[model samples]
Target: MMRALCLTGDPVADKLLTDDPFALLTGMLLDQQFAMELAFAGPQKIATRMDGFSITKIAESDIEEFVELCVTKPAIHRYGGSMGRRVHELALHVVENYDGDTEGIWTAGRPKPDGPEVLKRLKALPGFGEQKAKIFLALLGKQRGVQPKGWREAAGAYGDRGSRRSIADVIDAKTLVEVRAFKKAAKAAAKAG
Candidate 1:
């Protein structure tokens, strides 16, 4: 079943992320230095520019030309140039490491297919740190239903059910607001502590 994600206000953009695992992964990669909705919408924008979201295509694309595509009009990210490089590199990494099948990273083919292994794999990806990897793992479990064993433990606080603290908990506009508030509070706490 395709899960409906309303993170991007635009239905088409959100649909692209929800329907394509690669797109979802790309969206997560783009989540930095940009608003959540805009970051998630990036894959759709790139698909529109490139005419598809094929990992092979992105990996093979010329870096300079891809950067131009990423910077045109409503740019893919706040820092389109660096982000364009990151996205292209990520596509190459996916192709080389996962055989161009983003699903393989989390699916049955995984050696362990458990939360810790999944987090380890995510952390190995470009642009993913410990916190980002854990949050993505939580998003997989909470929204995409990719719960391997010990997923909750691997995801840390983001795995808690009913927690409106991240994109995983965002189901609608109201929840989006809640997630933003939670992020704000967390940021403040980090700064204070």
Candidate 2:
């Protein structure tokens, strides 16, 4: 178990994330075009709206109704309709590919799991681009202690223990602020470049 996650300031929602692999995965998937805290809180909001957060349930839900659920008050994402579709697609992928075991995306495979393989799997998932895959790979190591061989190298700079560059390094409100500031600086640098 991940013990604790400070992603959302809400203890209950954060606890749900810690205890549920699917919630953690879904939260990571939602971490775009929205505030980090809101993105992390999304799975809980989805669980409340859907009465459960099962992968198969989400995968089988009606598309229009699921999109409506996402766009309802305290919507799941900024682009709720699209994000909801992505979430549903992600669930279906998990169910179809991993037998509903979200953890398999990171843990299953070769006897000695390699980080690049895990990264490849993450990148294959809906909403997981290269940066997102690396960030989540780093999160698995830095926070959840799910480090397979070569995880740090695979995660690149995001795997640096003390870096405040991404959610992988956020352990408290202070780290959250630091990460936000770091991201702001990086975005500014990109714009200038």
Candidate 3:
């Protein structure tokens, strides 16, 4: 069963995230230099503006047009132009690598990839880096139930049970506040160090 996500406050946006793997991935990709709720809301904007969201459609879209859609009023992110390009590249990667199945990054292969392998695959995505990939892996294991062996270890600190570290741990308004507080404190500590 697919668990509902409350990353975006908007019910429509949150529903999209819960029902669409690519949307969730796109949300994670956009979850940078932006507020978490709005970042996760981006896919719904794209879906509404484009009439629908499809991996192949996005991948094959004209770059200029897609960027324009992304940078429209209430843009997907503060840096909509760059993020739009990144999203396009991500769609292309998904189509080429996983035949447009976002879940295949973790669920593919004969033996079914373990947690580390899934992390490796996620890290290879266009906008995903080390921490982002790990957080996303943790999100999958914790909320989306994509756990493979060693998942907790592979996710590093983000996988800690009952932790309020990242989006992986965000389940409601209260948890969102907790995560924000945690991130703020961590940022302060990093600066003080």
Cα RMSD to the true fold for all candidates: 1.4, 1.2, 0.8
Higher lDDT: candidate 1 or 2? 2
In candidate 3, how many Å is residue 92 off?
0.3
Scored by Cα lDDT, where does model 1 land? 0.88
What are the runs in model 2 whose C-alpha is more than 4 Å off? none
Per-residue alpha-carbon lDDT of model 1 for 66-110, expressed as tens digits? 999999989999998899999999999989998999988887462
Candidate 3 C-alpha lDDT tens digits along 1-193: 2478899889999999999999999999999989999999999999999898888889999999999999998999999999999999999999999999999999999899999999999999999999999999999999998899998999999999999999999999999999999999999999999
Across 28-108, the per-residue lDDT of candidate 2 in tens digits comes to: 999987899899999999999889777888999998899899999878988888999999999999999999999998878
lDDT score at residue 11, model 3, on the 0-100 scale: 93
In candidate 3, position 27 carries an lDDT of: 98
Instruction: Pull out the clashing pairs in model 2.
Output: none
lDDT of each: 0.88, 0.90, 0.95
User: TM per model?
Assistant: 0.95, 0.97, 0.98
Give candidate 2's error at residue 36 in angstroms. Answer: 0.6
